[model samples]
Target: MGKTTGFMEYDRKTAEERDPRTRIGDWNEYQLPMAEAELRKQGARCMDCGTPFCHTGILIDGKDSGCPLYNLIPEWNDLVYRGRWKEALERLLHTNNFPEFTGRVCPAPCEGACTVAINDPAVAIKSIEREIIDRGFAEGWIVPEPPQTRTGKRVAIIGSGPAGLAAADQLNRAGHTVSVYERDDRIGGLLMYGIPNMKLEKSLVDRRVNLLREEGIAFVTNTEIGNDITMEQLQNDYDAVIVCTGAQKHRELPIEGRKLDGIHLAMPYLTQSTKALLDANYEANINATGKDVIVIGGGDTGADCVATALRQRCNSVVQFGRHPRQPDERSEDNPWPEYPFVFTLDYAYEEATAQFGRDPRQYSIITKRIVGDENGHVKELHTVEAEKIPAENGGYTFRDIPGSEKVWPTQLVLLAIGFEGAEDSILVGSDLEHKRRKVKAEYGQYTTNLEGVFAAGDVRRGQSLIVWAIHEGREAARECDRYLMGTTRLP
Candidate 1:
């Protein structure tokens, strides 16, 4: 609501990008920054609609509108429009603990649901938000704000991804001693590994981790619970324990030739490549050099695989998905503010299309088998045509088309079918009970069956967006605080 006539005056302007060729040469962020003047214009585009769904952050029609954390979007946009960059950053950080991460990685569900998008293009909210934070960093306004004093109570978090980190941030702000534990050699779970450095630079995560450390939020890497330390010890050592380990068990494709060497889980492949790039690895890295790679799955992770393979000098890269090609525009089924399924090119796909003759995506493809070479390594993928059959139930089923099988030339096949739940490595003797072995936490409660234990994020809710994880973390922290203390003030 910066200006009544603002939405009419400005068109949506997002940040530009570095040339694909130049950006692909390195494993860092490629999104170019917008000049302050242009950014101000973009800020002015905030119509501040009467409904203002941008801050609602609710899932309407199965899509997210506004910031899930209820970021003060219009207020900050007004601040940015008036050239008060520091104030804008303050407003951005008021609710969002890590705008730096979300500003870049989030799918911007808010913009998709923006009221202006009904007739005109939505405001460049994400870009302007990023601008606010980057300007804060440039002005040295972003600093570590550790707790002034510590309460007698102590807490332990079992993961360092956004969920755990968010919980620690809240609990520590509540004056409790907080220590995070991660099984990986590094602190971040998926943030440090599952995502590629090119998309979300590892250094960015490291920057925040370093600040968390400086703020006295103890982080213990390589100290996995239920292994390095016992769950009983954790329950007794700390007043409360929170499990924020992300859902990492990738759904398997138990098709023919499933054990082929070249076919690997998408996350592990992405993890290995990131660890190699970050020197966080002391093991053999997965490389796609001089290989024709077929990454099965059309999600962001699969796209990252394509980008990483290109950096490793892959001969060719092709991606496959069972879903049919979506319409270029949002369909009636995909209405406002809910996450709409539409055909849009991500950066990785854009780079691949620019370098290769065509876009690397093959829609309506269902891999039936992994074709292998003489040495037992996968050399190609056997796929069949697939169709979406609307089921009697709400969910649709994938129907295979007869005689549509074909072999796709490939040396590496990465499955990015998404995660199932938290790895079973840390569940033993944790006092947490599982309903059918799934984390048994009530929706919105986030409390596990075990006493004094809570779960959130992908661990509790399964694989989801960073925004949802952060939301759950915040809610879980509040619940934990209430359980620990007689009353709570956390929002």
Candidate 2:
């Protein structure tokens, strides 16, 4: 620990955000930086307990408790508290290949598992991490470090998301020639498109990609395997193949009027919006301008859609969730150390409440049908109030209440329910086995049924956080390294 009673002396403080009204005008990040001194004080709040659970990468009740990337949280916290930012940056990069991404977007489960959180507020780990990395970038400390020698073994990675990029970084560090293939025009699969720019700017993604390029990792964009290039060619040419193609197969709400013209999936809508922003041309974009939008689903994607619609100057927005409202505090059944199931206002909900007089979320409501006009454009949405009932399989099912049907005007609807699994177009001719829509690979090994074939990230584990994807990719690279040589030094 940097200070003996630092945890008691200093209270946890985090980064502030720009006014919602001002931030909504542009697609830039809203987080305002904290002074270096306040950030150091926040870092000093880390108790650094003897048995720190912040770094333990374990799952309790099937929810992440600690840092999934196994980041040296306490070590870095102490380094930051002592003003040893360069050492802190090194420690942050030891496990996480891209702290910039996680520091911005990760939900920060480490705070949930913090020892100080048992009594008072947890340390501002995410904010401290962001400061360390941002400072590193500003001071020109973050530069590409290519491997000293090449192993003469070429490896191919499909889908250039967090997992693919992480695996490529590790493999390159292990002296392997790594080449990443991305179907999209840009390298980041989900980071570049699925996520909105206000939360994480595209420039940050490009910065990391440029650093990877300097590290001797080849990024092949607009080229897909099994289509532009054959799977057989990959197997023959590359010493190993890692499939990090994220779960792009979005889940659909195939209900009444499902094929309506004004309805769309969340990813394509989000992707198109980002593309338009990048091109500096707003015409012919999938925007919610001058429309009353209804976003279906209650997860992060739905929240993102809500924010995106607000930014596009939508007249009104309502987000629907099928389940009941979560409690403000954790119940006995949902104790601490597991992901807190309590209700907290995300950025979108806060923005909506600020702009409009009320929160835009409507819980315990199910979409019955999408009402369309004579011209086939979506005009309104019909919904019914629902309640959860105990099911025979120890689960709950929604039961619609009679005489509770209502209709609301909406010109556009975005389905942000969730992803199903990996897309089939790329995996059709591959040798990898699959379960449901996900690629069949074990947790630690990350190997497919075929020899020398590996899978990771959402493709293997289903939809998850970016930190988990990085962890999976790193482990997969270690396994791949071991497979290539009798012994390996990768960690």
Per-residue lDDT over 1-491 for candidate 2, one digit per residue giving the tens place of the 0 to 100 score: 65668889988888998888788888899898889899878888888498888888788968889898889998898898899999999999999999989999999989988888887888899999999999999999988899999999999999899999999999999999999999889989989998899999999999999999999999899998878897778888899999999888999998998898899999999999888889865554477998999999999999999999999999999999999899987788776677677798888888898889789999999998997999998999999999999999988999999998999999899998999988886568676788888999889999898778899999999999898999999999999999998678989
- Output the worst ten-in-a-row residue range by lDDT, candidate 1: 429-438
Scored by Cα lDDT, where does model 2 land?
A: 0.90
Give TM per candidate.
Answer: 0.97, 0.98
Q: Pick by lDDT: which candidate is best?
A: 2
lDDT of 1 at 254: 91
Write down the lDDT that model 1 would get.
0.84
Error of 2 at 206 (Å): 0.5
Name the candidate that leads on TM-score. 2
List the pairs of residues colliding in candidate 2: none
State how far residue 99 of model 2 sits from its true place (Å): 0.3
